[model samples]
Target chain A: MERLSPRIRPVWLTAAIVQAAVSGGLLVGGAVGLTRATDLADAVGLAESTVVQGAIALAVVLAVVRLALAWLRYSVWRFELREDALYIERGVLTRVKTVVPFVRVQHVDSQRGPVERAVGLATVVVYTAGSRSADVAIPGLRPDRAEDLREELRRLAIESEGEDAV
Target chain B: MSRLHPVTALTKTLGYAVQWASVPFFLVSILSGAFDVVRIDWVFSLAPVGFLLGAAYGLVEYYRFEYELSEDTFDLASGVFSRRDREIPFRRVQNVDVSRGIVQRLLGLAVVSIETAGGGDTEATLRYVGEGEANWLQREIRRLTAENDEIEADEQEGLEPDPTERPEPATAGTSGDRRPTHLFELDQVELGLLSLTTAKLSASMVVAVVTAFGGDAALGLVLSLARPFGGPAQLAGASPLEYAALALSSALYGAVATYLVGVVYTFVGYYGFRIGEAGDDLVYERGLLQRYSGSIPTEKIQTLSIVENPLQRAIGYAGLRIETAGYGPDGGGNQSAIPLAKRSRVERFVARATGIESGDFDRPPTVARRRYLVRYSVIAAAIVAAAGAAGIVWGLPYWYASALAVLGAPVGAHLRWTNLGYDLREDHLLVREGFWRRRTHVVPYYRLQTVSTRRSVFQRRLGLASLVIDTASSRTFVRGTPTIHDLSLSTARSIHADCRERLEDARRTRAREERALSVAFT
Candidate 1:
């Protein structure tokens, strides 16, 4: 299988970092509010350092885990286009392998989140018929490659449309 | 094509009255506490007036409902204030089911439910038609579908009917010349056997139903009733042998009671169960008090599953099930093809359903795969061992539980490894697996939407792979996707390649057929 583009590393890392920042920021903010408001702290029966240290530890753990996951995801994300189907493999802990046949493809679209756009990457989403978990997304492709893949899939799908009703 | 039976008005009114009955109980409960509600019965009596109003409304609604059949479509128009009209084409209809409940039976009426291609519950349900009228309507729809096919075929051959040539109405005389062949039917003995073997987890259901009807006090009553007979050891210092015999007899009594209950249930639900094939459709009829009849077209069937539970296998019998599009939990359709029959009978049924020669599925799984299963079981045993050790250290003496894992792991691994099997025919694929409920899924290549060989980190190290074959019918719980797991990498690869080629061939032939039909029509 062909590996996804190397630039995907940075795109994934940016997403993970943003996600960690939001959650970590919430915990730290809550801890700081508890520490500064002594009356509230006294009512809850907690000291300032305990809350502050726990929040810091949680933030550090989240940062470390998210960064490691991003790298692992980038390494594992791969896809290949066969004659009649597309194969995809991704996930760090629970690896998921998905296959989408051209005959069953209903539609395809290229999506770009703000972070992906900033990193000059796009994700192509393939919607299939008759399955709840059949949608396959190929992320971290350059815009041109994504467009090319989408058009090729569309053509293959049209060619096979007469055979399968869905 | 007309309005439903006249008694339908009464049934609809009764349904509405049931909903309104709760109001009186709620009002009485609320007012009995603070106010002297017992002194003023009229305050609690208003709910009857609500029922009367609902009954009057139902009469008007029943008067507004109407339906008619055109040459090519079934038209239903119903509503009291806002008129709604629906026209379903004959070509789009998939299966037609006729059902009757106790109330409908008393009124000599039935409910006809029509399901179409898309999974939208029921495309249309014509409620409470005369029993004879419901059967007539079902046959009429099937005849129309057949004629529509013939007309399309003729049109494709450049023999399009002139504008002056009006389509002929399907009458009793001109539907089909094909006679229906009697396929299978369950006798009293077979029905009893089926019931005895059926898995019933209905003890909880029995408890719940009794509680619902009798309130919380009934639970304690039931427990007290059973207490004397349930515990043989507690019955005054008896001999060990006597205690064991009592326990065995009680268990036997419970089993017999449960079996008798199941027999009654099956006898009522599956009375006169019969399957007959006419032309390209299979018709099934069953049930006693509430009868049901359904017709499924042969082409709509996606897969044929032959299943055998441990008991059924021991008795040399199996169950046959067929999956059609939109026929499952979401579709509100029944999928029972055959409840249970001898193995030979099942093979014949399979041959007839698929139009293929009788095939065998006796392939054994590989030894290497068994090793992997044993290794996985060992890891689980290790975890249990660690937990048991920890329990022992904590002074709970729970390490004895570890013996269960030590013994059960090997048996489970062996059953799983031995049960796995797959057979790839030229035009079809058969996958048989499961230890408790052995199932063989026969899928034609044309039905397959995707076939992928997957390998995980563990499989990679072992040089093993698994094949997943998916079809559109995966939307249903009864028709699951067939997966052939734990094969050598080379074998999996070859199977994948073979499946791909067969799928391509099926698609090409399908395209050619469509092209030929289109050309003939033009």
Candidate 2:
């Protein structure tokens, strides 16, 4: 199994940080809203400042945990180009190992989302004929590399001469 | 081009009248405000006009509907104001089903629906066609599909899985050698047996139907009628043994009701279930009030599923379902090819249909057995905890009784592990699983769409993974995707590679075979 490009680490970290920040921001806003709009803290016999402090503390803890797990997730993520199929092993808690044979691949595409674009990374997606687990994606690759991978898989899929028909 | 049967005018008119008149009638009543504040009794007159319009629409549809059988395509033109025309190539036609309800049957008419490769909806439907025409259309389409294969084989190469060329199916029909070889016919005894073993969940639908027809008052009346028998249980001096006996007898009564309901359901659904082989096609005709005659090319069958419930398994009888890419009437791609058959006969049928050999399954590793034991034990413990929690909350006694389930966890786990096994053969992949209704999915390598493996956190620690094999069939009646619950990571990878190679090899061989057939055809 090959790990994703080392460059993907920063991009994943950025995404995880942004996600955590947004969630933390929402928590802060909710805490402020509750303190201002209702006497929930007073009714619960707790000070408003304590609620805000708790939100900030919980936010920091969650962010730290999320960023730490993100590092682990990056470490665990892997993709292997087998002779006849593309194998991907991912997920942190629940490990998923998927093998999409070249013959079953209907189409392939290389996409660069905002986060990926920010870090000069691209993702190559393989759409298979199967309904479930239809889209297989290889994330955190250079644009040129993603394009090359897509072309190679497409060529292999074409060469396999799958029925494409039932 | 030919118009729809004249009977459609009458049939569609009746159908539309009911459908259309109800809307205006509903609006008029709603606008009338329970006939209190608003006196719009004159608005009721609009129902007749709507009915007339609907009748006219139906008649126009019948007259305007025109279909033509060309050399390669089936053309259809219909619709009122917006003219819609569809041209379906014979090659794309997956299934041709002829079905009829009471009205159509009485009128000697059938609704012929055409199914294609994409989506769940029926591609084209002829409202009411002559029974003879429906049959002819089915036969003609099959012939054209075969002819198309011969012509397109050279250009398209091995892109299509040609169902017709395999058995030289259509030439026999063209030569007028139309003798159909009978495969399986459901008998009275077999139907009864099938009904008896049916899931009680469906039998509860009998109560819903009864409620729909007779209302809640009737149900209350029934309960009241049975109150005398139930009253004995509530009697102040009732013995514990009497109460236990009453509960047992009531359970028996419920079981009997389920059997009776199942009898009616299966009997109606599969009354004259007769499947015969006409060339390479399995032509099935079944039903009591609503009859259906559909043909699924044996070569196009994606998967073969053998379902045997505990009772059926004990009696050595099983149900076989034939799945193709074309969706069936009930949104599934499976047809009950053999609703009830001898287990041995079912095995033979599966072998004949997909070349799936009957052999011993390779059981999962010893860790899988331990995994099941651990899972079941946890579940049992959870139930005991929940029972205790509920007891404390509600002040209920006998909370300890639920703990007894933990003792049976080992037996449950053993049975579950023993039942789960898979056999990867040369041409077919057989996966047998499930304890209650054991389903053995026989998926030919030719139909293998994709294969994937997954493992949860607990499984990863145990070095175990699950394999999921998919086919082109979309209906997730647990149809094409047969999954093996537990296998070593290395074994899973090997199996995945093996499956991928086998699928490619099978397709290559099948393509070569088709090329050879095309050469012979020309």
Candidate 3:
């Protein structure tokens, strides 16, 4: 279980890159405008070029720091299915735990987007009768693993219902 | 059971023609105004003459409409010069809603709207019938349909019971007597509590006020209070205290007006509120100033819900709304048979009417956690913070505004979310949701016509999906729950599968039991 999955690293890397690009754009725009409006470059006893370079470096460093934090956030997410319920634990610093019983299940749906399909993976969604936010979806499962899990859960849910196993 | 009076169509046609004639009259008025601009004085005189002609045409059309009843079918004929005929089989008629408008009250006529399950635009209507005749027709239709169903059941069993022997009441197990069961009736206290909880009254009052006083006045008054710091000078130099006094007085006046309108509307809408069992059907008759009578077959009612608003919770009152199949103006086109009743009473009623057992669940439905408060507050807080920050940056006083926002937004959100809940029992699924006017719907396992599951990308990441259940009731047609998930995908699939299997099992068991009974009797 401790063995690192190469695919997982790329997923986090891609997300971090996207976040960095957005944050970088905003920070650069703000710093550049501030530099253009103020005479601080001359008053600071530093060349304007040196001040501009410093500002750009500071913004890049900030974006990189934020991206590293996000990478750590996604790494902690984990899910497991037990005999009676499905369990999920996820968080960066504040942990969240969720348990959904088999009997409360209403319907199940499987979905795959371009990214997931490219990775030969699929997501399974579970719905209950009353709770909208309580619904959960599990993604990044290999096709075979997802199908096997679906079958196993279906069996467990039917047995738990104790009436019809259609 | 008796037939409807033949004058229904004529009265209805007269009403329809009068309504249609208004368009042409308005168009002619505009045309006359245009002509007057060019000094055509004679054209203006034609307006009144046109009105008279339109009224005369309506009267002629009214007399031409007529309908007759036969043993298994009802026939209607209408149209002045060109005759249009409609034939409706008794079995196809889903429900009969009899209502009386102001005109009907004056003329001593009742209007009957006949609905059917088949997907067709044609609906049979009988206008200008005596109230007594309308009631008789309703009973006749119900009796005929019930008799047909019993015969069909007997045929399926290959044995027919004697017609002389009375069939057992549907609620025989719960209620001792065979007399039609009255499920629940709202007393004065229950009615008052219901009025306090629901905004139906206040919403209607707002509509009435806006219509009476132009929208501009309403908007101006609202804007003045919302941005009070804009100063008295902004409101034409009125002193702060004077403006405050005016606002307070106006609010007091509005509140009084709202209360009166609410009481009157409630009295009319739910007057003589009654829910009773008649054969294999449930009947609802209400309205004070105008009467509305409708009936739903037990088999056709797809879902039943008992809902409680905050006010109702304090007073122990809950509203029961039924969802049925077929297309009506409202969703699922199921009518509210008993709009308001005590929660305890509604629970007892559901247990008695349907064979399913009823009790409080070990856990409230998960949707209660997703209540309106949590969802709305999250959005409201973000929006308000952003707005407050922008306002402060723009040199506006933000403290007072932010304080007011903080006080109201979260409370409103929580109230909305707290009222939402859903429970999936062994035999039925119940959904309770509403912010101001709460409603709960109970849907039986067998009556579910379709089940669907959906998921968005974010939901997929969280391992969540939404499930929708559709029934035949028109009332629940628009009120179907969009997102109900507390289970995993496989679990949901199994639940759907189980429900379908159980439904089949019940059908087979009933058939086998009927067969065994018939064989033994023979």
**DockQ leader:** 2
On the 0 to 100 scale, the lDDT of residue B347 in model 1 is: 82
lDDT of 1 by residue, B1-522 (tens): 488888888877787676666576577667767687453365457778867777777888888888998999999999888899999887667778899878778778899988775544677888889999998888888777767655553453344335433333323223433555677788787777787787555644553464458755753454344456543434567554445445555455556656666666767777888887655567788888888888876555667788888899998988887766544322333366788888888887677555555656644446554665678678777978776655544433445666666676677777777778888886689998887888888888777766666777667767777777876553444336688877788888888778877877876554333232222211
Give DockQ per model, in order: 0.20, 0.36, 0.03
Tens digits of lDDT, candidate 3, B274-379: 7776655667777667877777655555566666566777777777776554444333445665567766667666666554456443222344344434556667
RMSD of each: 8.6, 7.0, 12.3
Q: Which lDDT tens digits does candidate 2 get at residues B1-522? A: 998888878878878877788788887778788757756665568778888888888888788889999999999998889999999987777778999888778888998988776565788998788988888888877767656655665445444546553433234333212556787899989987887777756786676566457766754544444455552434356554444345445456556666778777777878889988665466889989999988776556677789888899999999998777777785656788899989999888776555555857998998898999999999999999987865665444577889998998999888888988888887788888988878898887777776778888899899999988877765765534789889988988899888878887887677544333222212
The alpha-carbon lDDT assigned to residue B247 of candidate 2 equals 48
In angstroms, give how far residue B403 of model 1 lies from its true place.
2.5
Off by over 4 Å in 1: A1-83, A90-98, A105-155, A161-166, B20-68, B75-87, B150-179, B202-208, B211-263, B328-334, B355-402, B510-522
Best by TM-score: 2
lDDT of 3: 0.58
lDDT over C-alpha atoms for residue B194 of model 3: 57
lDDT of each: 0.71, 0.77, 0.58
- What tens digits encode model 3's per-residue C-alpha lDDT throughout A34-120? 668887655555677777777779878977776676666456657777655666554453344444556545556677777677657
Query: Which regions of candidate 2 are displaced past 4 Å?
Result: A1-83, A107-127, A133-155, A162-164, B13-21, B24-65, B78-85, B154-177, B212-214, B225-259, B354-357, B478-480, B511-522
- Please state the error at residue B356 of candidate 1 in Å: 4.9
